[model samples]
Structures are given as C-alpha cells and as structure tokens.
Target: MLTSTFGAPLAQKSARAKEITKCIAVFMAKDMRPFSVVENEGFRLLINTLEPKYHIPSRQYFSQTEIPALYKQTKEKVIQTLRQANSIAITTDGWTSRATESFITITAHVITDEWEMLSFVLQTRPLYEAHTGVHIAEILRSAVAEWELERAACGIGVVTDNARNMDVAVREAGLAPHVKCFAHTLNLASQAGLSVPRVHRLLGRVRRVVAFFHRSTTAAAVLTSNQKAMELPQHKLIFDVVTRWNSSLDMLERYLKHQSAVAATLLSPYVRRNAREIDTLDHADINDAEDIVKLLKPMKMATTVLSDEKTPTVSLIVPLKHMIESSMAPNEEDSATVSAMKRAILDNLSNRYTDVYDWLLECTALDPRFRTLPHLEEDLRQDVFRRLREKAVQLSNKTNVTMEEADEGDGGEGTSGPTPAAEQPVNLTGTAEEAEVEQPPPNKKTALEDLLGGTFTEPAVAESQVYCIESEMAKYKNGKPISLKSCPLEWWKENAKIMYPLLSPLAKAYLSIPATSVPSERVFSTAGDIVNVQRSQLLADNVDMLIFLKKNM
Candidate 1:
C-alpha cells in the first residue's frame, strides 16, 4: 500500500477503484428512505426550490395511472364517511369555467336533528351539455347511486336556491317535504318588488345619474365639488342591493336640502341636456317642488327607520285596524291637517296594504291539511281572516257602505210605507240564537237555513211574526235596519279552493321559505376561494379532495 495524499492506495489500482465505488454506493443506499413516510411540508419546500432551478421533467413526479387510482380510493372513502349520517340534504349548482366546460358541484349536508355541513363533493363528470332540469337530475342521481346511496334512507332533505332546474331536480329526486330555502325566497321577493314599475323608474333615474358621474372625470370632479359644498358624506356610485335603495333616497333627501346646488348643477353648461331634463320632469301627483319634497320626506324617514339596528315594527294590519276604528267613531274636533293625514294614510293603506294581506292569505291557504294539524290550521286561518276582515271593514266603513242584513217583512199595517228600525242598545253578551233573532238578515237567506247548510248566518228578525204590538210602542222609531256582514267569513268560504292549496305544507313551505339566491351566492363564494388562479391547474379530483378536506377536516 502507498500513501496517496490523505489516504492510502493499494498496489492493484483497478481493485482499489472498485472498492471505493462499493463504499460510495453503500452510503447512498443508507441515505434513501420510503417516499410514503416523508412529511409534505419539507417535500413541498424541496419541490418549490427545484421547480425554478431545474425542471424535474414535467408529468413524471405525478404518475398518470395514479390519478385514477387515487380518485377511486377517495370516492370510496367519502361514501363510507357519509354513510353514517341519518339524514343528508344536498345543495347543488352548476358553473362554467374559463375554458367553457360546465361543472356541477354537489354539497351534501348531514343533519342529525341538528343541521351541519358535512361533506362537499364535486362530481367527476364534466357537464358539457346544456344545464337543464333533466340533466341536473340525471347527474345528481348518478352521483348518489355511485356512492351506493340509491336505496339509503339517509337522504331526508335538500336545500337549494330558486333555480328552476335545481328545484326540478330536487323534486324529481323525491325530496319535496324538505325545507325550501327561506333565504332564497326573500331574495326573490326583494328582487320582484324592486322590479316594479315605480321602483324601476326611480332606480333607472338614479342609475343614469350615477353612471354619468362615474363615467366622466369632469362629472366626478363636479359631483365631488358639489358634495364638498353641500357637506355630504363621501360615497361611491357602486350599487349594492339594499344600499342603492337607501342611497337613492339619500340623494333625494340631499337634493331637497340643498335645492339651489342641485339646480345650479342641472343648469351648468358642462352638464348634459338629458341630465338637466330631470329637473323639469313633472310627477303627476307631486306637481310642485314643495310637493316633491313632501313626498320624499316620508320615504326618507322610512328608509332611515329601516336602516336602524332595530327592525321597523310596522305591520300590514295595525294601521288598517286603527283607521277602521277611527272611521267607525271619528273624533268630534278633527282638524283639516288631521283629516288630510288620515286620508293619505288610508289611501296608502288601501293601495299597498291589500297585496301584503293577499300574500298572507295565500300563505294561510298553503295547507288544506293545516286545518287537521291541531291548532295550527285554526290559528293561521283565524289570523289571516282577522287581518283581511279588518281591512275590508275599514274600506267599507270609510266609504260608508253599510253591509247588513235586510228586513224580511213589513208590520201587518195596511200601509205599504218603508218602516225604519230605531237604533237599539246592542246586547254584548247576548246568546248566538238571541242575537240571530234580533238582528236583521244580512242577505236573502235565513240564518238557520244557511247555518244548517254549512254557512255562518248573520242575526235576523223572524219573517212570519207580526210586530204590530211592538211597532205601536213609542220606543220603536222608524229607520232602515242595516244588516251586519263579516266580509272575511264570506271571502274565506268563497275562496276555499284558492286558500286551501296555499295552506298546504308544500305551499306554506314554498311561501315561507324566502325566494332568495343566498345558497347559490354562498356556493359561488366558496368556489371562488377554492378554485383560485394559483390552483387553476389542479385536477378535478384533487380540487374536490381539497374542498372536502377543508370543509370537513
């Protein structure tokens, strides 16, 4: 052996070289470990460092065959995980990617008496075709069956947004008894109400003005200058659903406050002629500027009230009740101002109040079987009838149209003259029979006859008996006897068909469940977070896996 710098060399150089190679190979073998046990955190860091320096040959690290295997394994695991749930509700929606490929995301909520979001699964199929009801149902059914849940009693409910296709899918899947998403219903109602002609006109004007200010730098500067001059708060022209309504009201309020500034802006040479046209626009009822101000004041007040932390306490029934009571017995010293206010409120109540009442009545009529469900049916029916009755009574009383029973026959006197009945003290505690006999017939039918025929008959005097002896009494002053008719009762009995269907659980659920798109919004938000630009290249299975893990684990 000979010394070669820091080490010794053998006499046989070839043998020595082979020995050195063997030692190096042993060291490298000792350093190697199974990839399965490796921690992902360090692996990710290593991959990141190598990604920019030297490409490890694209498509080599992730085996093409492994993807399908992993998906199969994951699918099995997910199905097993969800199998333990007693009840599962599914929410689904479809979205198209930038590549124009449609994808349907299905989120399953496992509810065990207490509702909770359990698992979210993105189906493997690419929904490339048109998103119709039949297609959605087919995809959903396939996914459910793939999980071996076709016959599973685990699925009890489904909550979704008000997409016609999605709703159709849910119904076809036989999940009708589920709670229809109330939040979605509310959104629908809000959208529908916002789309009304009056609302549309107001919104359109505001939108145009806002767009004008935003589109041009000069107009924006002018608006900013006006804002500073008027001491108005700095707010952008962006339209938010609730905020825009309030914002329009605010603009009107501000315009009313500083009419001169608005007038100056409208008349400015830089402002477009079309923009200035709003100043000359005449509303039919509100003729003058003062009238416009008056009209807007109440709306502004209402908007402010609604914006408060506490929800406003105005009910569709309360104002009508008060008006009816007032009309029945008007104050002796009613002033013109009071009379005008009353009339205005009444007119508003008359025009707007009925829709809400009609909606409520429709809500009550949702369930014909609701009447069979203990006190629920009666309570709902009575409440709806009560409000409607009150409204009708108010209208009738204000118009001074008496709704009462007609007298049967005249006294046996030979005179064919009209005999009037004097106002008698009403017996508040009188028996039903006694009241029925004393009161005049509200219509042509007899009370006893109608009641036996399954109708509520008003109190009426007997037709056969002669009242000559009673007529001779000085207390019996002549006046036409007005019959008392409960309009609500009549309406209820007459519209039973329309009302019963509305009272059904299905109908009540449909009505009570707000027509909103909140679920779809939530789904979109969740998708945005999960499928970001950075993760755009992720495999569909991995995307589903990531969402499932993040949502569940």
Candidate 2:
C-alpha cells in the first residue's frame, strides 16, 4: 500500500479525512459549486495545504456517496421538524432550466406551536412527463405523501401562480383553500394595462432609448460623464424583461432618475454624428412616466409586502387590494393614456380572485393589524366577523372531537364511561361564592317572567357554547391592534395560551399561508445557479439531492 512520508496510508478513513470529505460535500451543496470543484488543482492544493495527511476524494465519490448521504440525513431532520407542525401551507411552481429540462419545486411553510414561522424547500424533481394538469396534480399528491404532510392534523393549503394549469392542478389535487399568487395577479393586471396602445408605444420608445445606451459603449460613457458633471447619482439604466412587470417599472424609474444625463448624452454633438439611433423623450412623455409610476407605486409596495417569506402575508392581500383599487380609481387630472391604463388594469382585476376571496377575507379579519377592516364597509365588516365567529365555533367542536378521540385512545378512560363536569358557573366569570347565588322558590316568578323563561339574575338555561364563542370574539375584537413592525406570530405566542386561546389556533391556520409562490420561485433562482453551463449534464436524481441539501442544510 502507498504511504505518505509520515508512514500512514494515504487513503485510510481517518477522522480528519472523513470530516474534510463532509466539509467538501457541504461546500458543493451550500455554495452551488460543481462536484468537480474538488478535482480542480487550486482547490486540491488548498485542501492539501490545510491538511497534508488528508486525501482529496474524486468528484465521483462526492456526487455518488457524500451528497446523497448528506441529503438523506438533512431530509430526515426536516421531516422530523415538519411532523411537529400542526398546519402546513405549501407553495409550488414549475421552471425550465437553461438545459431546457423541466422541473417542479415545492416549498412548505409552517407556523410552529410556539408561533414561529418556518419554511423548508422540500424538493426540485425533474419532470419527464408532459406539463399537463393531471400530471402536475399527481406530482403534488406524491410530494405530499413523500413529505408525510398528507397526515397533517389540521389543514394543508397550497399557494400557486395564476396559470390556468396550476389552478386546475391544485383543484384536482384537492388542496382546499388554494390561493392565487397576489403578485402574479398584480403582474397580470399591470401587463394588461401596459398593452394599451398608447402605453405600449411610450414604453417602446423608452425601451429603445435604454437599449441604445446598453449597446453603445461610447454613448454609455458619455452618459456617465454627463451624470458626474450634473452631480447626479451614477446609476446604470435598467433593462426590463417582458415577463416581469416590476422590471418595467424599475427601468422607468431608473430612466427618470438619469433623465438629465441621458438627454445631455443623446444630444451631445459627437453622439449626434456617431449614434443617431437614440430616441429622446418629450416633456409629455416624462409626465406620463411619472403618472404611471405614481399609479403603480402602491402595487409595487404591495407586491414587496406579499412576497415576504419571513413574515405572514396572506392577511395583507385583501387590504393591499383595496389600497391598489383606490389608487387606480380615475382622477379628473389624469392624462388620457393614464386614464386608459387605469381602466384596463381595473377591468382585468374586476372579476379576478373571487374563488379565494372568502378565506383571504377571513385571514384579513383574523389578522389583528387589519381586523377592523377599515377598507371594507360596515355591512361587509359585519359579514366577515359573522363568518369568523361561525368558524370559531366549528373549530371548537372539532377540537372537542379530537380530544375525545385521544381520550379513547388512552384505554377508554379506564372504564369511567365519561368524566363528570365540574359544577362551576355557566359563564365562568364569578367567584365560587358568587356563583352560588341564592335562588328564589319556583313559585316566586312573575307571570311575564315565567313566560319569558326567567329573570336576568335567575336564568332558565345554562350559558350556550355560542355565547361563549361570542364572548371570546368580543374580547379579541376589543384588543388594540399591534404595531405594523410587530410579528403576528410573536403577538399570538404571547397571548394564545391565556388571552385568546380559541382564536389563536385559527389565526395560525390562516396566517401560515403564503400570499405568493415566491418561495418555490426562489428555489428556481438557486436552481439556475446549480444547473449552469458547467453542470448542465447533472442527473435529475443528483439535482434533486443537491437542491434539497442546498436549501435545507
């Protein structure tokens, strides 16, 4: 056997070698590096220098053994954590990589018993089948079973984009309480507005101007010089993508920011002779851009808020929708193009989101920050609270059933048949002495009082469960809303046990839902890095393990 100068065999499984191999695997997964990185001369030298006795494994060793083992171990830990979750909400989306291979990514969001929000990337499996609704539905069902989420004690909802196929797939999978991505809906509406001929033409001219600067090095240099001369922030122009509406807004904002520099650069004597293709925006166009920005600024803010993964955002959808609708309302001072654009957006959004509105409204009402629902009218507000109270009663009943089942599981309560109730006051509001108020004789009742069931002090019946629910609702209603900076989970953690036990669980169910498919979308963003040119031929199974470990570990 070959031996090093120190006389130990080079490839023996020492502790240091095992630890270094584990570190190398983690580096590949977490940093999105190709397995072959270990084989690179520079990387090999660095490892050897760090630990002369340690042997660097081949790429085959890491890819075949180390990565798979890491993924399996990390997956077990994630599954354990997920099993502890009472309610889970999922976000899933499909992506096509640079290799032209299709894949689906699923991410799970849960609110722990302690009211802390956690998210985990479940998988990113390559799709060999057609991207049909039935196929997608099957994939989703398999994913739920694989993750052990099908047996969730409470609800399992899914958030997805507004793709018709996704809607069909989620419905087919029977993941009730499906919510369309609010950001996607906003983008659809914005795209519709941008399709108006006048807006399209204006944007075409802006796109051309931005393209000119991007393509012409001389023109870009001139613009930078002009920016410095004008004492402006040296910001580069943003190019918009056709698929993303926010990117258009970003481009327009950057264009407007560097308007002075751009105008000077385009009008420079040398540029007039050299690059005559650049278009100049007139004053009216500038005003139109400003109006469009003003109209879309609220939506941009709403999108940012709903795309939040760290905080609860499903509750923000309805409130943010109301705000955007108000902003889109026609103003007398609006330009024709702006007015047309607003109408187009409103028309597109008019009949949308009807399917998920009820539950999202419930989420809004349950969220303490927006419980009052100032955006809604008085009657609508009442309706929301009514539905909330009804649900609370249902939840209470379900909890009772669950507790009973558990008791039965514990050996039939040792043949007690059923436990006896404590002889406490029906309202549970008075002391023991106060609850034992002296009752008058039956004959002391007046005729009217006897007909009406009883007098106020001596009620005829016990307090109904409905009344108890109403009291809890009232107490929750009277609470002052927490600040916008406070996390709803943190607030619930503080109060769920003692203050509003019944509603707090319901709050977790509603608030755990994500408002967008951005979690899965983010996974694709990382996937792009993993499946780049260097690793394009990576196998689908390896890709799955790598992505899972990358996100989870």
Summarize candidate 1's per-residue lDDT along 1-553 as a digit string, tens digits.
1133324433323564434333322222222211221234664466435332222222222223332344455566766666544334455556655444566776654422122223445353457677787887787777665654431111234445557787677667654323333333333333443444544565566555555666667655666677678786545454334523334445544444544444455566676554753542235312232332343344334333322211111111222233332452335564433334334434433333232343333333322222122223566645544332332222222212111211233332221221222122111112223222243333445667766634332222211111321222111112221222222223223433443222111221222222222333344545555555644555665545434433433
By lDDT, the best candidate is 2
Off by over 4 Å in 2: 1-4, 10-12, 151-153, 403-468
True-vs-predicted CA distance for residue 387, candidate 1, Å: 27
**Cα shift from native, residue 194, model 2 (Å):** 1.2
lDDT of 1 at 110: 40
lDDT by residue for model 2 (379-482), tens: 88877777777666555544454445446546644221212211111111112233332332233456777776555533422346667668878888767888
**Candidates' TM-scores?**
0.43, 0.88
Evaluate candidate 2 by giving its C-alpha RMSD to the native, one decimal: 9.1
Lowest summed-lDDT stretch of 10 residues in model 2? 421-430
